[model samples]
Target chain A: MKARVFIRLKSEVLDPQGQAIESALKNLNENNIKNIRQGKLIEMDIEAKNVEEAKKSIENITVKLLANTVIEDYKIEIE
Target chain B: MKARVFIRLKSEVLDPQGQAIESALKNLNENNIKNIRQGKLIEMDIEAKNVEEAKKSIENITVKLLANTVIEDYKIEIE
Candidate 1:
């Protein structure tokens, strides 16, 4: 199975990296944009019996290694 | 409009960060995973008349600032 994990900072958290990107865009005259947020996308192939198993496995991996639970949230997709 | 940009390394390029994560996962007994790739996900709100305009604007922003076309590929989604 192929699994995807989308890890994003929680909305309430400050994202300085994202703010930097937004400022850069503004400097380049992309004035229409706002509230820019940045995150991580992880894609991998996993050996699993079914989609459910893959999702579960990936979820475990995400919580343990991919995301900082105190400030980041993650969503998983399996295919 | 809401725009999402997914920026990923080209398949032929090396991703040392992803490899490190994969190694760590293996050390933690996640033996079922392989071919791990990491990418960036950027989300923002933009002022546009319609979805088409939103996509075009985001595409321009992505090409100009978000992605390094030489070694990375990017996809834009607008909603």
Candidate 2:
């Protein structure tokens, strides 16, 4: 199965990179820009006998290292 | 308008971060992992008199700085 791991900053977290982009946009005269956030998406192919085990593995990896639980959230999609 | 900038490495480019994650997963005994590719998603809100101008601004920014065109592909989603 193929899985996609999405790692994003928690809503309350401050994102400096996003802030820089926003500032750049402001320099370009793009108006009313707000709440810019950046995130990561990792796509991988994995093998499992069934869907459940695949999900379990992805979930485990997500919590273990794929995302920083204190300031990030993650979601997985199976394809 | 709101736009999502989806940036992924071109298929021919190697992604070291993805490789490291794959290696980590292998160390954990996860099986059949391959071709892990990591990418970025940036979400932002902007204002324009109309959709076309917003799209134009986003495209300009994307080409100018949001992504490295030589090795990345970007898609913009307007909302």
Candidate 2 lDDT over residue span B1-79, tens digit each: 7788889999999999998988898788775767899999888887788888888888888898789999999988898
Query: How high is the CA lDDT of each candidate model?
Result: 0.93, 0.86
Candidate 2 pairs with clashing backbones: none
Model 1: docking quality category: high
Interface RMSD of each: 0.5, 1.6
Off by over 4 Å in 2: B49-53
Lowest-sum lDDT 10-residue window in model 2 chain B: B25-34
Candidate 1 scores a C-alpha RMSD against the true structure in Å of 0.7
C-alpha lDDT (0 to 100) for residue B42 of candidate 1: 98
DockQ values per model: 0.93, 0.73
Query: Tens digit of lDDT per residue, candidate 1, span B9-71?
Result: 999999998999999998889999999999999999999888888898898888989999999
Write down the TM-score for model 1. Answer: 0.98
